[model samples]
Target: MKTLIVIPTYNEGSTIERVLNTTLEAIEGDILVVDDNSSDATKELVRNFFDTGRVFMLERPSKLGLGTAYIYGFRWGLSRGYDLFFEMDADNSHNPAALPWFLKELRGGYDVVVGSRYLHHTISVVGWDFKRLLLSKFGNWYAATLLGLKQFTDLTSGYRCYTSKALKAIGLEKIKSNGYAFQIEMVYRSHRKGLKVAEMPIIFYERGGGGSKMSRKIVREAMALPFKLRLEAIRHIFKDNI
Candidate 1:
């Protein structure tokens, strides 16, 4: 199957080149880097590989949210007739070595496959402090419980893959949330559509370069998203009944 790995980057020049090179070695598919007008020469680094035909870059005017980047990438991949799409981080946090496993599951008939850091009994995350770990765990738990996605152990995981059919079913253009909430919203939409979703264990490492994009605004959006989604669902049900 033709696969496309969509990586969104902003000021990730320090690690983007290495990440792309490693991904190329691990997987036999094209890659698209959606750069949000990075000032740190990230676009130039990716352009070096464009002549190879296997790599491509989409330059945005300024800093856009993570959700929009993936949405843009998804649309681009869909237009090119890519069968499978992978959402990966530009930083080395998500291992490219795990791509084969995800693809295997995708081929095995799963509509969506998530690389979970907390699927196993022992924590699979590295370099996270206790406070950050707690926040992550709690966030996942809260989202799953509130959104009725108990089957997912990592609703906020960024490492994931989706088939074109599933993305189409979820209505890509309608996705509004960005940041961590974007991940949750995708999973929730898939579940609502009754698509098959599976999770695989993966070791998540902290970024070796570039600072984190997490901020108070992002956190606030994430915290409010689940409730907003739930309310929307309730409104839909009520309208249908009426």
Candidate 2:
């Protein structure tokens, strides 16, 4: 199967090179970097890789949201006839080597596969604060309970595999979220569409080089999920559907 790994970057100079090289070595697939016109040398470094054919880069006009970055990458992959696609972090937080396990499950017929850190004791996170861990676990629990989703443990993890058919089913034009919530919205819509989703365990390391871009605004937006989804549920209810 032709697989494409889409990595979105924004001023990730400190870890980009190592992440790109390690990822290339780890996964046997084509790599595409969708840079958000970073102020750093991220674009220049990636262009060198693109020249070799193994890597490709897309320079957006500006720093769009993460959702748009992935959307652009997804469209690029689909246009190239890639059968499998990946959503991975440019920082070394996600293990590229563990990607094969996801492909194994995908080829075995799963439509979507996520690298779940909580799936087993063997793949625990190396370094994480108690507060961050709580937020993650709490967020996943809340989303699962609110959306009636089953099985998958991590909702915010970017480390995931998408079978091309699944991507085709989750039409990019229908996706609306533009940031962190985009991941949640994707999985929820997948469940609502009756697609098969699986979770595989992998250690997720906290970022060490660049500062975290999280903020109170992001949290506030995510917290608005219940109200937003609840309103949508009412619409579906009135329509006599799910």
Candidate 3:
């Protein structure tokens, strides 16, 4: 199947080349970097790889949200008739070596395969502080419980693979959230639509360079999106029953 890895970047110049090269070595597919007008020469660095024909980029005017970046990449892949799509980090936190495992699951008919850090009762995350870890664990629990997605261990995991059909069914253009909430919403929608979702354990490391994009606004959005999704589900049920 034709695969496309979509990496959303902002000031990721320090790590983009390594990530791109490693990803290319691991998988035989195209890569699309949706850059948000990075000031750190990220675009120029990526352009060097464009001559290889396996790498492509989309430069946004400003720092758009992560959700929009992925959405843009998704649409681009869809237009080109890609069979599989990946959401990977450009900062190398998510290992490129895991690409084969994800593709294996995809070939096995899983609609969505997520690289989970909390799967198998083990905390596979490295380089996270206790406070951040606690918040992450609690946040996943809260969102999963409220959204009725008990089967998934990592609702907010960005390292994931989606089949083309699954992406189409999820309605990419309709996605609203931009922060971590975007990840949760995609999984929830896939589960709601009865797509086959699978999780594989992966070690998530802290970025080696560039600052984290996490902020108070992102946290707030993540906290509220579950409630919003749950209410929407309820409304849909009520309307259908009526």
Number of clashing pairs per prediction, in order: 0, 0, 0
Off by over 4 Å in 3: none
lDDT of 1 by residue, 1-242 (tens): 89999999999999998999999999999999999999998999999998878999998999999999999999999999999999999989999999999988877789999999988666899999999999999999888988888878999999999999999999987688999999999999998898999999999999979989999988888899988998889999999999
- Backbone clash pairs for candidate 3 read none
Worst 10 residues of 2 by lDDT: 117-126
Clashes of 2: 0
Q: Give the TM-score of candidate 2.
A: 0.93
lDDT of each: 0.93, 0.83, 0.93
In model 2, where do residues sit more than 4 Å from their true spots? Answer: 120-123, 240-242
What are the runs in model 1 whose C-alpha is more than 4 Å off?
none
For each candidate, give its TM-score against the true structure.
0.98, 0.93, 0.98
Cand. 1 TM to true fold: 0.98
Q: What tens-digit string does per-residue lDDT give for candidate 2 at 149-209?
A: 6466787788999988888887788776766578887887777777898888888999848
